[model samples]
Target: VAVFTDVDCAYCRVLASHLGGYLADGIALQFIASPLSSRGTPTYMAAENVWCAVHPHKAFIKAYSGGVPAPAPRPCAVIVAHDSQVAHAMGLPGTPGLIGPHGAVLGGYLSPRDLLARLRMDAATEPSP
Candidate 1:
């Protein structure tokens, strides 16, 4: 699953809290920054900070644990900004936008079990090739 998330989004935090459940259900998550804050704001910077860390995956996990790294390199801001831009371009209404493996829009912030069920249902409904 690819999730468009924000550092300051409570829903994103809830989704992060369910990381174990997602992984246990064989859902490999890809986090994409989609900050609700404008560029240069602390919240947006927080997303950039995660990208700046030597281990961004670890930093991203820590960020959802109520913390973010120090201010990021100016360069990293571009990547984070691009992530938000891409999410916006995709027309996602808000953070924690959930996209299923086969491009299904899984709505937002669903529990792992529910998400898997949705995925399975979608797969079942698809016409056989």
Candidate 2:
């Protein structure tokens, strides 16, 4: 799944806690920062810091796990901005927008089981390449 996420969304933190559930279901997550969703939130800076961390993936885990990411190695405004633009172009409503394998965008929080079920259904209906 490609998730459009805000680095510090409370609901996103809840979802992050279920990472094991997602892994058990054979789902891998690709997190795309949506700092543009930072209207009333404070995660925009966190998003930049995460993206610029030496080990960005680990930084994501830390951020979503309710821990602060390490300081960025370099300036990261551009990449973070680009990610937000891509999310906006994809029509993501807000943080935690999940894009299934077949390009279906599901919004908000879903348990791993629910996510797997939806993915399975979508896959079943999609034509094989």
Candidate 3:
């Protein structure tokens, strides 16, 4: 379960808020943190800031939930660069995109129940090793 997300999207915030719910049920949710620079929404920059923060993942979740402004104006270009590479490799050009085990893209805002169902379906349909 790979979720590519941007910090500035309202839907992204909603999705993150449900991570715990999904995980509580034994779902392994991996993230790709895709930044949306083309939207001119400061998501990419904020992502860079979050990635550069001491607690990168936590800072991102907090900032995405509207807790505080970027930890600082400066950010690590390397971190942003790596994330960009990840986005390109994964063919993700927008925030709130998902790659389930079944090779399906789950995009847009989805409630936790919907997400759990999608993941379950994908997992059930996946070819076993």
Candidate achieving the largest TM-score: 1
Number of clashes found in candidate 2: 0
Over 71-121, each residue of candidate 3 has an lDDT whose tens digit, in order, gives 555557676667667777767657687777666777666677887887777
Q: What would the per-residue lDDT of candidate 2 be over residues 8-118, giving only the tens digit for each residue?
A: 677777888898999999999887778654533457778888888889989988888788887788887788888888888888877788888778887778899999988
lDDT of 2 at 49: 81
Model 2, poorest ten-residue lDDT window? 35-44
Name the regions of candidate 2 deviating beyond 4 angstroms. 37-42
Ranking by lDDT: 1, 2, 3
Q: What is candidate 3's TM-score against the reference?
A: 0.77
What is candidate 3's CA lDDT for residue 31? 65
After superposition, the stretches of candidate 1 with alpha carbons farther than 4 Å from their true spots are none
In model 2, the Cα lDDT at residue 125 comes to 89
For each candidate, C-alpha RMSD in Å?
A: 1.4, 2.1, 2.9
Better of 1 and 2 by lDDT: 1
- lDDT, candidate 3, equals 0.72
Which residue pairs come into collision in candidate 2?
A: none
TM-score of model 1 relative to the true fold?
Answer: 0.92
